[model samples]
Target: MGSKLSYYMKILLGIIMSILLYGVVVYAQSDALGHEKWEYVLEDSGDILQIAIPVSAGLITLLKEDYKGTKSLALSYGTTLALSYTFKHITKLKRPEGRNRFDSFPSAHTSSAFSGASFLQRRYGWNYGWPAYLLATIVAVSRTEGPDGYHTVWDVLGGAAMGIGSTYLFTKPYENPKLEFGLSVNRSSRILTIRYIL
Candidate 1:
C-alpha cells in the first residue's frame, strides 16, 4: 500500500509540475508575443513540450516498471543536454530575437524534445514513437517560427540531430521477459533448447 501510494504521488507530482511549467511558459511570453491566437498556441505548446515530452517518457518507463529504460533515458537525455550546450557555447551563434546574447547554435527545447521522442521510440516501439516524434517536430518548428523565435533553421536542425544521435546511443528496444523450450531434429541429430528472454 505504501509503495502504491508513493507511485500515485509521483505521477500526481509530475502532472502538477507539467501544468505549472505550461502556465509559466504561456504567461512569460504572453506580453511579448503580440501575435495571433494560433501562434500563441503553437508557441505555448512547444514551450510546454520541452518539459512535457521528457516527463511523459520518464513517467511511462516508471508506469511500465522499466527501471532499465529509466536509466537509459537519463543517460540519453543527459548526453543530449551536454552536447547541445557544448555546441551552443562553441558556436556562440546569435539568437533570432537579437537580444545581443550569442549562445543559440542549437535550440535546447528542440534538442530535449527530440531526445525524449527518440528515447520513447527506440526504447518502446512505433506505437509510442510516432506521436512523440510528431510532438518533437512541433517543438522544432516552435523554435524557428513565431514572432519571438529563438533559433534559426540550422539551429533547429542541429538540435534535432543531437537529440536523435544521443538517444540512439543509449536507448534500446524494450522486450518482455519470456521463457521457452524448443526441440529440433536434423535427421540423425536431435537438439533441445531452452531460451529465456529478459
Candidate 2:
C-alpha cells in the first residue's frame, strides 16, 4: 500500500511539474529562438539516436521475456503521443519558421523519446534510465537545431515534461503471478522450503 501511494504521489508530482513547465515555456518562447547552431551533423546524429529508445526497450523486453514491461511501454507511448498531439492542436502555436509553421507547440519526437526514457526508468532503474534520458535530451536539442529549426527550446521542454508526466501517469507497476516466490523455514525440524506462487 505504501509503495502504491508513493507511486501515485510521484505521478502527481510529474503532472504538476509538467503544468508548471508549460507555463514557463509559454512565457519564455519569445527569447528561445536564437540559440540554434544549424549543425547538420549533430542534427543527423540526434535523429539516429532518437530511434534507440524504442529499439532498446524492445530489445530489453525480448531478452528478458518481460511481457509486462512491453505492455507498460506501449501504454506509456500511446498516452504520450495522444496527449502531445492533443495539446499541439489545442494550443495552435506556430513553429519557428519554414514550410511546417503550424502545430509546433509540443514536439512529438521529444515527447516520444522522453516517454520511452521515463518508462524505462520507472519500470527498471536509473542504470537504463539515465542513458535513455540523455539520448532523449539530444533528440530535443536536435529539434531546435538544423536549417528548418523545427521547434524552440520552450517547445522541447514542454514536450519533455509532458512525456515524462504522461508515462508516469500511464505505466503501472509490474505484476507477474508466475514469478512470485517465497521462502519458509521450520526451525525445529531444521527444514527449509522455497515456494513459487505459480
What TM-score does each of the candidates earn?
0.76, 0.70
lDDT of 1 at 151: 89
RMSD of each: 6.7, 10.4
Best by the TM-score measure: 1
Over the stretch 94-163, how does candidate 1's per-residue lDDT look in tens digits?
8888899898889999999999989988987776776678778878887887557888999999999999
Top-scoring candidate (lDDT): 1
Worst 10 residues of 2 by lDDT: 29-38
Residues 12-50, candidate 2: write the lDDT tens digits: 435534543454465433325543333454466557655
Output the TM-score of candidate 2. 0.70
